[model samples]
Target: MSGFNNRNHAVLLPERLARFGPVEPGAKVKVRIPTEHRSLPFDQAIWPEEAAVLRTVSRHLPNVPKVLATRRGFSVQTFAEGTELAAIWGSKPNVKGGVVEGLASLFAALARIPVDELPKPPAGWPAFGDSTGFIHCLIDYTRTRVEAPAHARYGPLFGALGFPADALRRFSDGLPRDGLTPRPFVLLHADLHPRNLIYNEEDGSLHAIDWELAMVGDPVHDLAIHLCRTEYPNRGERQRFISAWHRAVRAANLPAVADYRRDLPWYVGYQRVRSVYTDVIRSVELLGPAPTGEELDARAAAVCRVLARAWAPVGLPGSPSLGGVRAALRDWAAERSEPGPPLADLRARLRRRLAEARTAFSGYFAGAPAPLPPDGPPASASRMRAR
Candidate 1:
């Protein structure tokens, strides 16, 4: 597919494969497979092995896709039948009228769902009304899952850019795990953003897809993620969304937001910090072992933007300029190569396989051919699609 917005590899199976799709009405259908790009340990997932969380949550949320099935390890769900929300609200997002009201109502409905009715939560989930403990869970997951795993390869790069080895630890230490206002834990879409939302102008309704990162946590945590992920046209529009969110939460009788004003910034801060590390590492992976001038520049520009925003949030000693970030990424990549080799010889071998390695990860279905080809060879995903 030309557009792949999710962390998972998703495909719209052709009509012949309709027997493998869910038994819903004759609508568009797609299947999802977890991406092999082992980049980060998810802070948003509580049960890593549970593939049915979306299906379970869908059972309760009617607007959510209900007839989910699995085939050859791919989770099949009906395509959201509407215009992509991001397309409706272009780069300059509006905050007034039905857009604001509809988004607010969606959040309110999500909050109102009784936690018991949803899927069984993971062990060691925060006790009832434990906002502080809830945040700690996320911070710890970032440290243990995201940071620790990436340390061997990316630790030095982080240090080079002024991120302390103990950044996550410090953030965790400063956080109070119990005394903060007790916000009741509730279902969080965990990855909600305009791209994940589908808007139907006919009925003025919004539907959300991709609940792979969904979790049960403090409600404000949900708001913090939405605020960070969705691009607002301006500050006033952002505040409007927040105001609408509070109004809707109160109307839903879910008092999981009492101290959101005080707590929102840090949760927002945490997300920014997480993005810096994740973005840089992702750049390195995308560069592969042999990045061309254009590839390096493109990745550098993106990383530099995220790195610049992260200085204050992660307590970096100094702000990162674009030039410095490009240099750091360059040095980091060079340092990763082995001590002895004809660099040209090694790269020649790697370059031949790099194209297949990248696309196949995102497109390979069990026993299915590879994904879209790069024109060098007929990739298995592309071949399967053609057949």
Candidate 2:
């Protein structure tokens, strides 16, 4: 299988399970190479810690992929044998009945794991068993890891565009924390969207992959992140899924499930605000150097849309107009000139050809207006499926 690069380095390879010198002779294995991008500092240390988490959690959760082998930077696991739920559902799965129940059951099982049984978190993690402090710590991490660094790098441009450097801090301070119910934390697979889930049609079972972002945090925050990343097509489906999760966790006697309804909106707002920093960095990174006018316009539009969605959640005075965003990007692009590799060079060539053709077709139509960005912002979470 071909490999691709995103926030992490990953490759999909099919090898006989026997190669690992263990059970399941002819079964295939999936090789995962998790890399840390310094620019995206939201995750804790990866590799060994995440590998340990996977091995520990798989013992209790049968759906988790079994770790076959591990070393620095890479690991191999028994390949999950099923279709990705996202592929089956085509982006937004309908969550009307059994689908919701299945997901809820998965969440309940995850919450039921005794916190003491899990491996100790990497050093400097807030002392274990302090759920409320952990939640507050997460907010602090978003400020230090994400917002601070992002502001230092892009402050002048963003400030010129009307988003002052103090925006994220103000937003964090204003989030209503008084009404939050103090709920016990649980081991959470913090990134659980359709893409990370594999569904076995034969038995109707769902398996979760990609435990890199797993953490011991507020259970309600986990559900909030899941719902926001999953992008349910409508509010009705979102509520149905939440209700199913509520019932499933309650039936399992997990007390934290009780606070989900009252607390979810705050976490949702946090996710939205966190996304602005990451997405802005991503937009600027994608701009490389010497971008064409059209490329700059497209990227600026993308960043502007993200800023617009985040403005309400962060209480920004105003968002930059598309023209202002474009100008800012142009100025920033002029200051950086990092050359990409040969493959990137080839892709750039192809992109230019496609853009030229698109321009010609537009001219033939008397220059009809270009289509606007989508109705809403893109998902703030990583959508890459585990291979």
Candidate 3:
């Protein structure tokens, strides 16, 4: 209720939990309306199956929200009562020991869910319990669902970034496959960032909401994603949490715990590379129809940071220089512009038409646009020229 607001006759809730509640004296119900589009393809494919999964899992896990009713694109659940864990611990350098223990217990319980009891995975899911194969499948999804679709949508803008169509495939191929032994899969709360966790201070219980991304996979992969997304205060805290996790899973007799050290790095790397595609696409989309020179520079800098970290893991080329990025973006904007009524607009229209004619035969790939020319002016200089 804290983040909910009424707008246009709809109550906005967090994440994909859409619309609910006009607070009467004692309303205790919440509604979740699935969104039309999911940012990731896996979520898109598996979301329709979540209501059933949640219903099944709730019978086993008390902290999971109880589904009171469900229909296509919408469901009603009992409103979870507690403070969001993010509000309490997200900015803190460290959390109390009990909090860590609670989280560990929660994950262990989820892992104990009988895999046979859960619904079948959506189509194209890899064989059950094949952790390495599952990751390979994700790499392919990154290419087909994330990169290819993004390229098709923002062809001209992305083309200027100098990545070839098979960039993701190349990146996936670069990953080491030597120690990827198969392990028994278990139910996993795939997205386990702080925001998705609810902590009841009085009882010291942690409730996990948001089953939209849940699946059965290698339990260690779940742990890896949790650690990456949660952003522990420091390496020591992360290690402590990992130890707690190992104890919990080992107690539950989950076999995946044994290979945690060997497999974690690979899963973490995959998470980082997966983020690259989404972040780059989101950054470009944020540029809107018209962006200031400063905005372009900032966007480029943000993207470069992600690319720099991901470069080794994904086998990417060096990030373009800030100047190069600015020029490339500027050129893309200019090419995308159409004729307007003013004289300045006429020049833009002329440039766009000429560009089209030059690359017309290439369909969309006529002249290979290089990164901003080396001699191009800096962002400040470009802004001055614009003025």
What lDDT does each candidate get? 0.64, 0.65, 0.63
Q: What lDDT does candidate 3 reach at residue 363?
A: 28
Per-residue C-alpha lDDT of model 2 across residues 319-375, encoded as one tens digit per residue: 559998888888887874443233344344433433443353332222211221333
Listing every candidate in turn, what is its Cα RMSD in Å to the true structure after a full C-alpha superposition? 6.7, 11.4, 13.6
Off by over 4 Å in 1: 1-25, 48-51, 91-97, 176-179, 288-298, 338-387
Error of 2 at 75 (Å): 1.3
Task: Name the lDDT value of residue 291 in candidate 3.
Answer: 75
Per-model TM values vs. the true structure = 0.78, 0.77, 0.74
lDDT sort, best first? 2, 1, 3
Candidate 3 lDDT: 0.63
Off by over 4 Å in 2: 1-23, 36-38, 45-48, 91-97, 122-131, 177-179, 290-297, 318-320, 337-387
lDDT of 3 at 52: 84
